[model samples]
Target: MTTRTPLTRARLATVGAELADEVGFEHVTASEVARRCGVRVASLYSHVRDADDLRALVCLLALDELADRASAAVAGRAGAEALAALAGAYRDYARAHPGRYAAMRHRLDPATAAASAGPRHADLTRAALRGYGLDADGETHAVRLFGGLVHGFVTLELAGAFDHSDPSPEVSWEWSLTALDATLTGWSTR
Candidate 1:
């Protein structure tokens, strides 16, 4: 007889994340995850409250993972180099794990969002923007702007929105970074 492996919240989440990558974030239900783990849906309830909880766990996991990548990408770098590193991290991660990328965008309660690595992502962005000489308000704005720009580009690229166009996504991405760098460097004067 085969012994069943013990299930835990973390393991369930890992499986859910993998499933998300395989199927899609929207389809990652507790039943599906349990099936993949060779267990029943009830088995997951002890570890997770419900499907929403499972998804939330996956979202938190994705946030932590992405933040780690972004942090490492920006380490010992500054200015345009830092910007490119940070953006590249997001783009690459999304390309590698589109489902996890979608999970990272999942809505979280305020407390959960505060406790997750979501803030680390913002902090990394703030640090990356420091060399641009932006004031507090400027830095805040830059963080939002940069996040939107990178996420937008990645989302579009993943959806094949750029596939039919000339000037490949890479070329457009590089151009966007250049423009962003120039704008940030001259932010104070503007």
Candidate 2:
């Protein structure tokens, strides 16, 4: 007889994330995860409260992973270099793990959100903007602007919005970063 590996929330979440990658995040159901795990759907309830709980676990996993990548990408770097690295981390992760990227946007309960890597992502953004020499309010504004630009661009790019566009998405990405750098450089003076 084969001994079965113990099932845990982490393992289930990992499987869910993989499923999301294959079938899209919206299609990651607890039944599907159980099927992949070779277990009954009812068994998974011992570890996760329900399908929503499983999705939330996957969301937490994605947030933690994204923050880790961003932290590493920005380490020992500042200004435009740090900005580019941070942005690149997001774009690359979204491109490579579209499902996990979608999971990262999942809404969590207040306590869960506060405990997740969501705050670390915020802190990393604020830290990365430190070299821009912005005041407190400026820092807050800059973080919002940076997130909006990168998220909007990546979302559109992933949807193939720039696939047939002229000048290439590569060219536009570089230009956008350059413009962002220039804007941040003059932010204090403005």
Candidate 3:
């Protein structure tokens, strides 16, 4: 039997995230991850509980990354500008890391979800909405609306749904942001 070297949980998570980007998040396996790390499968058990745990860890990593990007993008901006910045940041991150982006949307155990960077994401969204004068309900609505648009556009773009379009994905992305800004600005209380 080959000797296995110990890997830290952080190292394993980084490798797992990279592997997810390589072969798709769903295809990531502990054995394969261990192989990539030059360690035996058994060695990974000491760092990660199993495939589920690794996936959750990956989700956490993705969430934190996305939150950081969004926060940075929206800093020193407000209103539609801030919204556009945040939306663009999210789309840019997702496009750059499709597999990791998918991992961010993966459902996690309740405890994991509660403890993950999800709250940070929510706070970022809420902060972005401050410029729009959105209250609690309006902020929630804006969040869902923006989330749907980003998710829908990215999903379609990734699946080649816009490949044959004339305007190009980038152009459409800009137009979408413009339209989103208009919608948020004109939101009605009725």
Candidate 4:
């Protein structure tokens, strides 16, 4: 038997995310992750419990990456500008890191989801809406709306949903941002 090189959990998790970016997130496996890490499959068991564990770690990593980007994007901005910035951050991240982006769509365990970057994401959204003075219900509505809008557009954009159209995706992206901004500004009215 070939000797296996040891790898840290953090290192394994990082490589797993990279693998998810290369292949589909659902395709991520301990064998594949180990292969990418230049190690035997058994080596991975020392780091991750199994493929699911690795995927969960990857999901957490992706969420952290997204939260970091969103936080940076909204720094010092207010109201619609911050909303646009946050939305831009999500769009840019998804387009650039499709696999890692897909990892986030993977359902994480409840405790894992709560302990991961998800809360930070929600906090960031609420903080961005702070200047708008929305009521608690309105804030929750805005959060869902923003999440669905950005995610829906990105899903369509990735699946070539806009390829057959005459309007360029870039134009549509800008238009969407403009519309989202308008909606956020007038959200309390509806």
Residue 150, model 3: lDDT of: 87
RMSD of each: 1.2, 1.4, 2.4, 2.5
TM-score of each: 0.97, 0.95, 0.92, 0.91
Put down candidate 2 lDDT per residue, 1-190, tens digits, no spaces.
Answer: 9987789999998999999878889999998999999999999999999889999989998898899999999999999999999999999999998999989889999999999999999999998889888988899899999999999999899889999869899889999999999999988733
lDDT of 4 by residue, 1-190 (tens): 9875558887877888888778778888998888888888997898778788888888888899999999999999988889889988998998888888988988888888889999999999999888877888888998888899889999899889999987899898889878877777777633
Instruction: Report clashes for each candidate as comma-separated counts.
Output: 0, 0, 0, 0
How accurate locally is residue 36 in candidate 2, as Cα lDDT from 0 to 100?
A: 93
As for model 3, its CA RMSD to the true structure in angstroms is: 2.4
**Tens digit of lDDT per residue, candidate 3, span 27-67?**
88998888999988998898888898888888889999999
Where does the lowest 10-residue lDDT sum fall in candidate 2? Answer: 181-190
| Residue 79, model 1: Cα distance from true site in angstroms | 0.5
Question: How close to the true structure is residue 162 of candidate 2, measured as C-alpha lDDT?
Answer: 97
Q: What is the lDDT of residue 25 in candidate 2?
A: 94
Stretches of candidate 3 exceeding 4 Å from the true structure: 1-6
